[model samples]
Every structure is written in structure tokens, then in C-alpha cells.
Target: MATILSLSNVNKNFGALTVSDDVTFDMPEGQALGIIGPNGAGKSTLFNLIGGTLAVSSGTVQFAKQDVTRVPAAERCRMGIARSFQIPHPFVGMSVYENLLVASSFGNSGHHDAKAECRDILDRTGLLPKANRPAGSLTLLERKRLELARALASGPKLLLLDEIAGGLTEAECHELVETIKGIRDSGVSIIWIEHIVHALTAVVERLIVIDFGKIVAEGEPSKVMADPLVQEIYMGISVDDTAA
Candidate 1:
């Protein structure tokens, strides 16, 4: 498959702290890839680097065969990259529909009938019923839905989901997972960073385990999860030790 996004020896530093250490990976076109690791392992940092919110310290980022390491976030969005935050903070004062309109207008240049497209996105994300509701009035799940809707309105080819399922009920998470599956089925590539392994596994074709800003493992979800190194990162002990 052709690569949609590629990071070559990407690195990010905040003074003495190196958040991304020569991170390199490729996201195949139309693939949903899951990222898993302990907290502070540079998961979000990688997203930032990919989405153009943060520049790489010493590497290249390519999107659709174009070098975008120096691209601005807005330009990248217009170039088909969009992301949701771990904690959604949508336009609180605006209605949900309005939020989508804003995103579509900005991120989807030359899109005709953005309103119709936004409506479709609202329906797809299960946010149609609340489209007229103020964003600030939404519950956690609703906010997350709105976040996904807004990203869709941006017309993304690659969607970056950053812990969007962090605070949902089991039922709520399942609903979101189904919605995400629909998105993946619709051919939107996804890079989901989530602690909820089941949710990621349900929607992603592959899994990558990151530690200290580098990919520790990458493969099919089950095999990657079962790797002793991945188990130690998650369980804090070798599987042999745990069994013994």
C-alpha cells in the first residue's frame, strides 16, 4: 500500500527533555493504526509532531509525498490532517452545528455546500440530534462526538484521535468505537492513541507500542500486545514472571 504519512528520524526536544527521540514510522493509506504505551511515553507528542502543532527537532515529516515538517497546523489541516484532543474543548459558546461550519469553512478549502457536508458529518458521528445544542452544554461523550464531527468536517484523510475515549462509560466507549469503525470503513485513515486496548483493537488493523518516544513494537494487534516487551511495558513484569 502507498504511504500517506511518513516520519523519518523525527525528534522533538523541550530543552533538556527529548520528547520524540528519532521516531520514525509510516502510516499506510487508508489504514487505522493504534498507538499504545504508558503515560508520558510521548504518544501525544508524536501526534503533535505529525499534525504540525510541533516541529521536529531533527527529522523529516512527509504527507502524501510532500515534505511537511515545516508546515503550519492550519495548512496541514487544509492538507487533510486533523486531530481531536484528549480533553475536548470545542467552541463552548457556539452551537455544535456552528462548530462544524467553522471547521469546514477553514479546513476544507474549495468545498462547495459545506453546510450539506457538515450535516452529513453530523449524522455520521451521531451528533445530528445535538447539532443545535450549545457545545458547552454537552456531556463528556457528547463532547467527544462533537470533536470527532468537527474533525470530519475538516475533510481529513488521516484522523488523529488522542485519548478521545479516556473518560467514557463502557457503553459510551462502545458506541464511540462503533462510530470510529464506521469512519475507518469509510476509508479515513486513523491513528488512535488510547489506553483502552479493546477500543483500539476493534478499529485498527495494526498496533504500535511506543516507549521513551520510540516505537518498541509494531505489528498485528494481538501479536504486538502479546510481545514480552510490550507486556512488560504494560504489566510492569515479564509474562514468564507473571505466570510463575
Candidate 2:
């Protein structure tokens, strides 16, 4: 498979604290890459660097073979990179369809038809029936789906998802995982940072575990999670004592 994104010797620092230390990886096209880590592990910061939300302190970001370390966020969106925040923050007053339309128009250079794209986005995201409802009235699950739809509206080849299943109920997370699977089936490469392990395992063929700013494990989902180091990180997080 072709490489969709590459991080080479990436480094990000906050004053004297190093958030990302010599991080390197490649997200292959049409594949799902799962990133799991404890809170404050610089997982989201890694996404910010790839999606152009934050400037890297040092190193390179290559997307689709073009170096995008200095590229502005909006330009990166137009270049086929789109990310959803951990917390869904849609335009509260706008309808779901309207929000998607705005993303398609602005993020994709105003080339898409507003009405057509809005309907298609809603349909694709399982939000067609809620298209006319105000975004603020959505439940947590709906909000998560909208966040995904907004990213999809940008027509991304590489999607960066940040803890999308954080607050969803178990059943809702399963539904959302299916939605994500549909997205992957449509040929988009996904790099999802999620704490919902089951959902991640269901969708991602490969998993990468990061700790203290660097990846400690990367391989098939079951294999990576079974590594002693990976098991150690998740040891106290859940009451379920079964091994990964």
C-alpha cells in the first residue's frame, strides 16, 4: 500500500518539556491505524502536528509525499487532511446539514454543491433524519457522528480522529465503530486516537501504543495490546482484568 502520511524524527516541545520525542511512523493508505495511550501522552498533539493545528518544534510531516510541516491548517484541509476534535464543537445554532455544508464549502475550496453535499454527508454519517435539527440539540452520540461528518465533508484522503468515542455508551460506540468501518471501506485512511479499546480493535487492523511521547508498540491489534508494556499501561484503567 502507498503511504498517506509520514512523520520523521518529529519533535514537539512545550518550553522545556518534550511532548513528542523523535516520533516516526507512516499511515498507509486505505488502512486504519489505532493509537492508544494514557491521558496526557501527547496523542492529540501528534494529530495536531499532522493536521497543521500546531507547529512542530522540529522534524518533518509529509502527507501524500509532500512536506507539509509549514502548511497552514486550512491549506492542509484542502490538501486532503481533516481531523475531528475529542470534544464535538459544531456550530450550535446551525442545523446539522448546514454545518456540513459550511465545511464542504470552506474546507474544500467551495467546489461542492451545498445542498447536494449536505444531503450526501448526512446520509453517509447516519444523520440524514436529523439533518434539520439544530446541532446543539444533539445527544453525545449524535454529536460524535456530526463531528465525523464535518471532517468527511472536507473530502479527506487521511482522517484524524481524536477520542471520538470518549463519552459514548457501549452500544453507541459499537454503532459508531460500524460507521467508521464504512468510512474505511470507502477508501479513506484512518488514524484514530481512541480510548475505547473494543471499538478500536473492531475497526483497526493495526495498533500503535504510545507512552511518554514515543511509540512503544506497533503491530496487529491483538499482538500490540498483548505486549507486556501495553498491558502495563492499561492495567489500572479498567476493572475488567482480562488481558488484551
Instruction: Point to the candidate with the largest lDDT.
Output: 1
Estimate the lDDT of model 2: 0.88
* Residue range 1-244, candidate 1, lDDT tens digits: 8999999999999999988888888889999999998788899999999998888899999998999999999999999999998789799999999999888998845568898898998998788998899999998878988888898889899999999987788998898899899888989899999988988899998999998888899999999999989988988523433576
Compose the digit string of candidate 2's lDDT tens values, residues 154-216.
888899999888877788788789889999999999999998898999999999888889888
User: In angstroms, how far off is 195's CA in candidate 1?
Assistant: 0.4
The TM-score obtained by model 2 is 0.93
Model 1 per-residue lDDT at 60: 98
Error of 2 at 77 (Å): 0.3
Cα-based TM-score, every candidate: 0.93, 0.93
Q: Which ten residues in a row have the lowest lDDT in candidate 2?
A: 235-244
Global CA lDDT of candidate 1, please?
Answer: 0.90
